[model samples]
Target chain A: MKSHVFRPLLVVIGLVVIVLIARFFYVPSDFGSHEKGYMYGWHRKGNEDEWKAFKVKYQFNNEYCKDCHSDKYETLARSPHAVINCENCHGPAMEHPSDPAKLKIDKSREQCLRCHYPLPYPTSGRANIRGVDPEKHNPGVECSMCHNPHKPNLRGMK
Target chain B: MITRRDLLKKFVKTATGVMIPLAAFEIIDPKKLFADKPFKTDEAKVRWVFLVDTYKCVGCGLCVKACKTENEIPYDANVTRTWVERYVVTKNGNIYADTPKGARDGFTTNRIDLGMGKKQDIKKEDIKKAFFVPKLCNQCDNPSCVQVCPVGATYQAPDGVVLVDRKWCIGCGYCIMACPYGVRFFHPKYHVAEKCNFCYHRINKGMKTACVGACPFGARMIGNIKDPGDPVTKILMTERVGVLKEEYGTKPQVYYIGLDKEVR
Candidate 1:
């Protein structure tokens, strides 16, 4: 009777250990759904702090983001947008970074379009109709030429 | 004796199991530091390259100012991303920076962080004129940041362009640590990894970047190395070129034309 009870309990414990081990490796470590919306990059995993570090550290971005997304930081640092925080474009992302791919940060062009297509950016000092002149210029034709991340101006980069 | 391969495998396994986020700082791993593979990169894409012509450069701060204004970058507490660096190599082999003049003319001193990295050496222009070199992203084939990224947020594309996918990014700033050029920056708002995409959006649509379009000196050039007959191809064939910190084996894509060894 004692052996029977011990064996079943041992089997349950073994299964739990196996599950934990599987979670530690095969699982992508990061998970969660970010519903913060584009205004804040709602997800928390891939966040704004990473973006700023990328801009501040490098002279010319050498694609530092690859392997773990050093691309945005690398490109923006060299481009005109290196000044602004990544959250401005991506939105709140505290939930996604820790959980891996739980959030879809760059799934569509909505976040970029908010500023790139003439939206009244709700950020502080950013509500001055500071949006893109989509009618006049093709964002597809070198958006970084005129706009910046820190102070994206429509008058073109002077 | 425990083989090196066994040690490496042990390290990777240990590292993967650890999964702890580290603060941004250069950690010279003994395993990585001792690797003898020169230019032995693990990157999975073609690398982007930049070729800056120091001789043709006109000490204009257009690139610097443009980079700031376009990036919305706040006034520097440290350095400027891309700017023209001017140096004077004299006839007697006395090297000097014709600054105050160069700074006034935007020839150099983008790093407002270090007394603007400025040293005044004004003299007659005829004795030794200043030559400008533009500093920006080298877009190395073997990037330090890529190797250092604990996660796979940063990646290179097949077209040789470096890019970031925000979704997988963790904002760890590891890439910020390993870079020798000091080109990467952190975003204030997103708290995620962001950098130069070669104006990938525009380039994909067949257009040049702002600096390239605004360069009045005809100094900046963008190219597709695949097209052998391109202007960059022609320049590469005839011009003298150099890169920064070659000892790191990063294989920087940015080439300096008419580079002076004494500039460092």
Candidate 2:
């Protein structure tokens, strides 16, 4: 082979070897194509653990609150509001009865009206919820002042 | 001492000797070649599906707020994991749609933006019909985001949920551009690609997604599509459900019971 051709060929081979060595050292051992086939895309298996470790802010189950506030839990469980989660109105219980001690409870008129405002949409299942026109029904007073959230039914109210 | 023809014949013979054994090894046990390195197996038996009953959504925006809080997304950030859009169609067939603050705040005004700094107050009598439709990441069966991700940072999990590895993402923004649904966004703080993962942390613990738990109206639900007895599966089988952008062929898993033609 000619010296010019041989020299360029050696340089190219050296470059290829360097890249291969770099890739071997740089890529994580756990990285690969996963799930069903290569169509799913490549990812590091260890990264899934990072996502799984994430702590959700909202506590879906009411059992956690039951440990601390059994009376309120019992009252809420039997009421019409049984389907509602405690955290839905109260802010996220990520750190409760300890760090912040108590979760912030929303008592604003807008909070009650979020579910109780009379919307004209008939097709929506929200029509089944007992709603009142906020303007007509004691405008300034909060709903909690006249009613109880734990026992939402008027008949159950003291 | 070797002539050109003899040299060529020797090369061919040596090549055939090498090729035959390699071909036989592939034919006999192809997996054995790659089996030396251990790979993670997806043993999950569940296939998750999301159901949205548009008829049941009153657009209170609790789901949006819940998603934001649960995911730690900034309330003031323009990006949202989920949002509700209000669509109002006039009697004359003109359509107007708007999402104010990603519907984090409930729809307060009756006015609709006509675009380019123009707003029109829609009267009750002039409107033919109006409805709210919630939008989120479809978590498609064949996600274009996964396909376009140069670093393979975005992928679909075993439960049919598409996820992004924030650490692995190079912030190329290719996946954001490839997504037809426009669900992907750059994280405000991290500057990497971000989107909804259906609250994977909660679901794996046998709890509902944050948005689903926040909905007081039973408008949003999640169930396993693989289980024959699952409510979502039954509804998908028996009901007239629709997905957004069927023409895109992404095979979106989010099913809507009352999907309207006006919805994009």
Candidate 3:
């Protein structure tokens, strides 16, 4: 009888319906909303673009700083520090680019010591950044004693 | 001797029973598993590349600290986005390696307190040659981490930087194990796989990576390799570069200059 075949088909259909309903709940509606060309073809669900919008809160580029401090920028270009960005030590200048007075120039000794502190590393290392032990090299004296911050090399400046 | 009306009624009942179950079972479609929504695809504008001059690295460890601070990573935690390794070969053909706190506080041969010290005291003069090699995620052309992530949470961005979606990550360590370089780790706080993203947050803003910016020596270099005007690109074109584990065929984007044969 046709009823005999229909009974088996009905059971199979019941199982399929349960699986389909489970999938609908398990799979998120927005699975691939943000990840268009990313790896694994999976969409990024995080605030991946937050850095793009964070520009309004911070700016670290040196080009805008060069606008107002062109003379210093010119000097830096001629010195060994040419490649270093101004914001490395001075912090982000997003506000300073607009209001020049907002720029915070850090003249602390810690700033200079960050790069110049002496560590007993291998002599063969080619940093070209001559390190000095703070207490032994120039005890109680400021780093600006013998070196110019803008042009550290006396021979190069001359 | 059955009536026509009775037979018709039985046929109708059987058909309804079959069709109702069929409709329910047909609801599961495999296409839905891979169905992707239309999103704005950002074109690959610049392919960023990072270069390390192994001969020039002084084991300063400033890059590690800078990365830690930039990424707001805790100093004491086992998680490190980047680190450096010092490879020392003794004259007697003994190999010694150590990276205390990932060399975040620099390295010194005088001290061997990282619990990696040898049983025999080897004098410094007995060492044949030693050098520091900085390590980070290679950002391979064919990264295995991307292939193993079950949820597709870790992926390479359009700019060619491998990144992790912390929000979507189910704390699965598959990507961590998939990386052959041992660069990936599970963040203790976020509970997700974390690796060097090349500081995409900074690079996207047209700024150098935290490690590159922190290096006092011009040992670490990064730039858009595609742009001819980029100085880093010029260096890459001129220098004879090598990648770690080339046999793996990962095709890592990070190139190294003066890489010694001993380094793995």
Candidate 4:
């Protein structure tokens, strides 16, 4: 090859080498397209483990509470509120009965009113929820005081 | 001297000589050439699907609160993983919508601020129709957020969930901007890009997503679309469903029942 041709080829080779070296150092070893095809895009293999090991705060199912509070669990199971999880109102049980020793119970009127508040959204299926006019329904009082959440039936209201 | 045809023939022979072996190796073991790591779940067998029955949603905001608590998002932060928007369409064809505090403190008033200086109360008689629609990360099949992440921090998992790698995220806010649904937000404390992942940890353990479990009115649901008997799959197969912003062609996995045309 001529001198000019050789010089340009050498320069291109050097640049390619530099780029390969940079990629080797910059990209993590565990990084690559994995499992499925490249449609999902490249990601570090270790990140999946990190996300899998992530500690979720909410006790997703109420079955966990059944071991500790069987009585309340049974009562709630039989009631219309069976669909409601125990941790939803009491807050997430991330490190409960150990770090805090107790879950803070939400006994505020606002908490109960979240579902019970009367709003005329007829199409939302909220009309079936048995809403009340907060002003007329014993105002300035906590609902848990009169109505037990475990047995939310009106016949058993305290 | 080599003729032009002879030179072309030589080049073709050399190309075939190199290509034959590579094609054979790819055909023999495509996985060996393409994939580096083995996925835990059967990627083909698991397609996570989400369903929202807008008709059943009472806009209690428990799902928002549950998501915040489950994901460790700060309670006071205005950004949220999931939110509920109340839409009020009046008699005169004016559309009004608002998401007050991400509906964390359920809707307290019927009057919408409309981003005006003062809140205007829409009279009950004048209202044509009103409804609440919950919004969350759609987990699109071809997610724009995943496409725009400069560092490849955001990716769609095998199960159709778009996840952000917090450690790898450069916090350029590119993914935040790319998201059509405006679901991505900076983590209040970590400052990395964040959005809903369908509560991956809980769902993997056979529990419902936080938002689904939190909804008292049975408005939200999650199931594997790959399974023949999965409720979400059944709903998708049997019911009339709609997705938001179909014109964008993101192929969102989240399905909506009774989705109103007024909802964006």
Candidate 5:
């Protein structure tokens, strides 16, 4: 091969090496910085777009959720659970109200495990397990299936 | 046909909608309390509810006194961890609510208005006619507090108990906004959202709630809806019971049997 082609090939090879190295050490899941960026920064949607263009990745406004879900907002405002954010359980609903059809709200048991999955993290505690293994517990069988959120744990409750 | 202006417009339109809240959720996750119960209801065998008959109320403030003594709630704070508000309605469309309230810890005869309370003069005959609404957590079927709990802290149990995981809660103050009945509040010492747990500590051990046991009027009832013969189930089937804030779609478990139509 001519020197011109040979030199260009080496440059491309060198670029590939650099890119690979960056990807390995910089995968977003490891530090979660990239995931945060992907979730929050680079993925910003337009200010006044239609539901058709709305994506689950779109940023949400609590006030917007409070618009339709005002009752939840009022009840939760002073509740003991008030410090917790709505997205932690509902799982990022910015896109939910926009199209609702396309936007996923994490309604499944796996979704509940996002934070509640009783990890060995030592902070969640084994006693906090409430009896079952968070890893093996299936909400489909029970747990949230019968419980009412408005008022909880009354007399003679099973 | 993509005009440069239109293309820019579309691009900009699509950008901002996705950015703001995405950024917000990062910091907000730590603050959520979960209302794990959905906005729907399934028939429960052991549905728990509370009933306070206005006619039975003698304005003695016994329940109020009982609540403060039991919960050790601060009286000076003017926060009823569970207290009664008196209302006096007259024929004139004039209503004077929260009149002559009392408590175990220094409750005044003064008519202190509570929670968007109404103050209107009624006919002299209408005086002392208002009933007591033993206000606390309604424990709705579709409880708004549970709906807004970001962390799933204030969730319903499998057997139909709306309990908060006081341990995992971050106390973001969202459920306070979510509840229409104005039941829950921030505990000053615990610094988390707190309300009537129906005396779970005692009830779990087969004892009744303090308020329930203390009521001399037999106004309150407790039972498992799962049982065919439970009193609450019987009353729900036999008597006309009412729930507070029904218009908001929160199907409260606390049923007011023999509740007056005009009672708020």
Candidate 6:
């Protein structure tokens, strides 16, 4: 190799070696521990605990209630309230399986009013809430008195 | 014409000049320089789908409020990551679409007190039909937002959630304009492109999106479509679901059931 060209080539090789050594020292040994691909190395921080902790604040899904309340679960499945999850009204049932009394079953008039309350929203709107003016319809009467939440069609009226 | 001593001094000066910057850069650590970490989850292993049951949405605005609070969106800004539109079609074929405060505050049609003049006059007898449709980032399979991002800051994760790397985003607003659904917005405080990421930080941890969680009615749902046993797959297979702007070919992950013919 020519002397001038050889010297420049040697310098370039030496620089690359230095860079590699520097990288070895700088980069964390476990930097890509959770990485699935090379294109992106930074994975979102947090183990499974982050999501698990967040979910506990919300009501558990209907499937969890089905394990014990299989009869009520089956009945609700075929009823108009089938779309409603068990925990939506009963609250989160996470502790119910372990301690049966932990489930707070709310059978209040205010609970039914959440969806069925009188509002000016269009009937064709999503949810199509058939708004009922409580004062005129049934004053001081609980919703469950007239219509069963499980089967809202008033099956027992006959 | 330069002397040998002069040549050596010149070479040494240049060498020092190059070495100083190199040493400084090396110590700074290039690996830590990355703006954000890539998604660690295996893409093919997860197929996320968002199901919007328009027939079930009550227009209560709880989802919108939940999203704003969870994401810490600016309260005063008009921009929204998600919103609801109440479409009222008059009997005379006149259509009026309005979203009061992006539905962050629940809607009320009683215009007498709200000072919405003449809307009350045309209402009771002239209205044909009305409904509420919630809107959010579609998380398109072929997202234009991702395509227009000059920095590659907006990208689709392997699990198919479209995400924005705030650290990497340049706030160019290209992604905001590129979106067909008008989901992207420049956050007032952060000065970055912002939109619904399907609550990725929460979903990554196996929790539902904040909006979905806040919905009192079963109006919103999320599931892995790739799983045959997933309810989303079964619903998609069974329901007469529709996507927004199918002609755009974005293949939006959000599927709407009971979407009216007039809804865009």
DockQ of the candidate models in sequence = 0.03, 0.26, 0.20, 0.31, 0.01, 0.13
Worst ten-residue run, lDDT, model 1 chain B? Answer: B104-113
Q: How close is candidate 4 to the true structure, as a TM-score?
A: 0.83
Model 6 per-residue lDDT tens digits across residues B105-200: 656443322225434434566767766788999888778787776755666666777777666678889988989998988998989889887877
Judged by DockQ cut-offs, the docking class of candidate 5 is incorrect
Q: Residue B73 error for model 3, in Å?
A: 2.3
> After superposition, which runs of candidate 4 have C-alpha atoms over 4 Å from their true positions?
A1-22, A135-140, B1-43
Error of 5 at A72 (Å): 50
**What are the RMSDs of all candidates, in order?**
18.7, 7.6, 7.3, 8.5, 24.7, 9.0
- Candidate order by decreasing DockQ: 4, 2, 3, 6, 1, 5
Task: Encode model 4's per-residue lDDT on B122-229: one tens digit a residue.
Answer: 887777888889999999987888878777788878787888999899899998998899999999899999999998888888888899988987899999998989
In Å, residue B134's CA in model 6 sits off its true spot by 1.0
Which window of 10 residues has the lowest lDDT sum in candidate 3 chain B?
B33-42
Q: Which structure among the candidates has the greatest DockQ? A: 4
The best-first sequence of candidates by lDDT reads 4, 2, 3, 6, 5, 1
Best-performing candidate as measured by TM-score: 4
> What does the lDDT read for residue B58 in candidate 3?
76
- Candidate 6 lDDT over residue span A66-116, tens digit each: 777798888887886686666556655445656546766667655665456
- lDDT (10s digit) by residue, model 1, range A35-133: 211111112343323432332211122232334656556655664555434433342232335533343333223334432333221211123323446
- The list of candidate 6 runs beyond 4 A from truth reads A1-158, B1-43, B111-121
TM-score of each: 0.49, 0.82, 0.68, 0.83, 0.49, 0.62
Q: What C-alpha lDDT, on a 0 to 100 scale, does residue B183 get in candidate 2?
A: 88
Candidate 4 docking class: acceptable
- lDDT value, residue A77 of candidate 6: 79
